[model samples]
Target: MAFNTSGFNPVIHSSTGGGSTCISGNVIVSINTPGTKLLYEAPQDQVAVTESFVELFQINSTFGADAAAGGSSVISGEYSIFVKLCFPNDPSGLDKIKTVQLLTHGATLDYTYWDISPNYSYIDVASAADYATLSYDQLGVGNSDHPDPIQTVQATSQVAVVHELVALLRNGKLGGYHFDNVVGVGHSAGSMLTQAITHSTRGTSTP
Candidate 1:
């Protein structure tokens, strides 16, 4: 992705989490239902799971094939994610990075959505304000790993990855670029994802 960092370090991080959800297009509607708490957990060591998407898909859909089963969507296995960061052009010149805007893009789009500088460049504007910026692809999109659509990559899984990144940022583990005032910015469906992150996390996120 084209970056505005005249002179700075850019950091990329990968996160893995799985055995999360297995949803088809129909189960998507239940996302907003009340009392819908989902499972989302990851290892701190960053070790990815070895199961394949195809295998997980078969198992999740084969619920009726077993005595205790019926067709299902709750998924299993390790989920991999990728995210990129852009620091201010001159870190020394800026005050201890005040605001960090975490960018989450919508469907069919990669992390490049926020970097389209010729248009409304979120990165350029934030960088001009000395804000550290992070833009990432959802787990199943962009540079992140691709898994079975029915076995993983649901809204909960997507939000789970965001939470993981927040922990990394707060702890100063993501490429050494740390900021307590992290903000989430998203577009379209990503806006929904950012809203999810904000509700689940203590920090601020703008949809």
Candidate 2:
């Protein structure tokens, strides 16, 4: 069952009710094996040291999803993983106190924190790039000009990409795209987006 990789929608997100509500948007997924492998290496402490952190409060309300899925397979079925890094707006530092809660199928998951150092350091490629350049815009609707808003776009795109990657793994089309197992890893805004992805639906639907 070879899946057609073409015609897939980009993942994106949107804001509703003055930041109180957020709907999923278009999402885009990229595959980076080297980076993904480095993220999961060795002792938990080692992984923490190697990986940088993103500050959610400092990040803007709008964000793009450019997640990368990669890994090698062991035996059990196939494994696919995606990583999202988010930086939120927190000039007052009050937002840091704000914690994001994750829910899957309407149940609350445990609250987790990322290893954020005093001097925040996370590489963001989109910062340099123009938001207009992205496939999705803020509408939460679809368009070639702008797929949807950044947040929804990222979430939806991540879901779509993960779906495709997992489909590939299940069918054994992805040779090295395998792993012992798979799980969602996110920090700050990325964590929020992961929560959205975990519960989002396809084709212009909001979750």
**Residue-by-residue lDDT tens digits, candidate 1, 1-207:** 222321123432211111111011100111221122222233234333223334336735642233123333444445556555665555464448756778888887987687663335666666666777767777767667776543366676777667666665665665544577778888999898888778875555422
Candidate 2 lDDT over residue span 35-67, tens digit each: 121112223575554442332124662211222
Q: What alpha-carbon RMSD in Å does predicted model 1 have with respect to the real structure?
A: 13.4
Worst 10 residues of 1 by lDDT: 19-28
In model 2, which range of ten residues has the least summed lDDT? 130-139
Q: Which parts of model 2 have CA positions greater than 4 angstroms off?
A: 1-154, 177-180, 201-207
lDDT of 1 at 180: 70
State which candidate has the highest lDDT.
1
Number of colliding residue pairs in each model: 7, 42
